[model samples]
Target: MFAAWWKLGFDTTLLAFEAQSVIALRMAKLAAGGTAAQAEAQRMVSEKVLAAGEAAMQLATGASHGAVVAGYRRKVRANHRRLSRGAKAI
Candidate 1:
């Protein structure tokens, strides 16, 4: 009876060890794949953010230029009006 118990115990231990090894290998594979995917996702997001920032900067620059042009045009019109009134008085 004792011998049978020992044999059974040994077999169970061996099977358990094999199962643990397989589980560890699978976990390693999953972790590696997850890490690679995470890196790729981060890189893509960063690229998208960079692109958005560049577009926003371009839009802001265009708006500022337009505002300056409009202001300059208003100033020129005012100057012309003043000169015309002065000429009429003279």
Candidate 2:
């Protein structure tokens, strides 16, 4: 149980950091006149917002921190798998 909490915190922090990096990179490209970056940046931003809202709801309802993190992990892994197959995020 302790390990689960630790992993959740660690993973959540890492995910947030990665989201910032993605946003920065996309914004840079968009600034450089890459029109396509606009959509990509928007999508990343939306994903972050969506995840935060969902996490908040889960916590409000008394979901375990570890369970919430695991839920995100599953989604991330599913996205990873889809991308590996040359697809978009699920």
Candidate 3:
């Protein structure tokens, strides 16, 4: 139980930083102004909506705090990897 809580806290902190970087990269993509920028904006909105749906499902299912944090941590890690690779990878 203690380990779960600790891992949740650590993952949350790392996600926070990675989330910021993802947003920064997304912002830069949007600012570039092109068809790809339009796609990027749409993708961002779609992802947010999907995340909200997942959160709703988690709430309804009574998922643990650790589970919720871990889910988001995984997502942010994937996003960090994708965005870090290149603008076209994601």
Most accurate candidate by lDDT: 3
Candidate 1 collision pairs: none
What lDDT, from 0 to 1, does candidate 3 have? 0.80
Q: How would you encode candidate 2's per-residue C-alpha lDDT over 9-65 as one tens digit per residue? A: 798887666545544555555565544556656766797699889999999999988
Instruction: Give the TM-score (vs. native) of candidate 1.
Output: 0.34
Q: List the candidate numbers ranked by lDDT, top first.
A: 3, 2, 1
lDDT per model, in order?
0.50, 0.65, 0.80
Worst 10 residues of 2 by lDDT: 81-90
Q: How many residue pairs clash in all the candidates, one count each?
A: 0, 0, 0
The better-scoring model by TM-score among 1 and 3 is: 3
| Cα TM-score per model | 0.34, 0.54, 0.80
The candidate that wins on TM-score is: 3
RMSD of 3: 2.5
**Which sections of candidate 3 miss by over 4 Å?**
1-3, 88-90
For residue 41, what is the lDDT in candidate 3? Answer: 86
Q: Model 3, range 1-90, lDDT digits (tens) per residue?
A: 888778878978887888898988878778888997898789878988888789779978999766777777787778767766767664
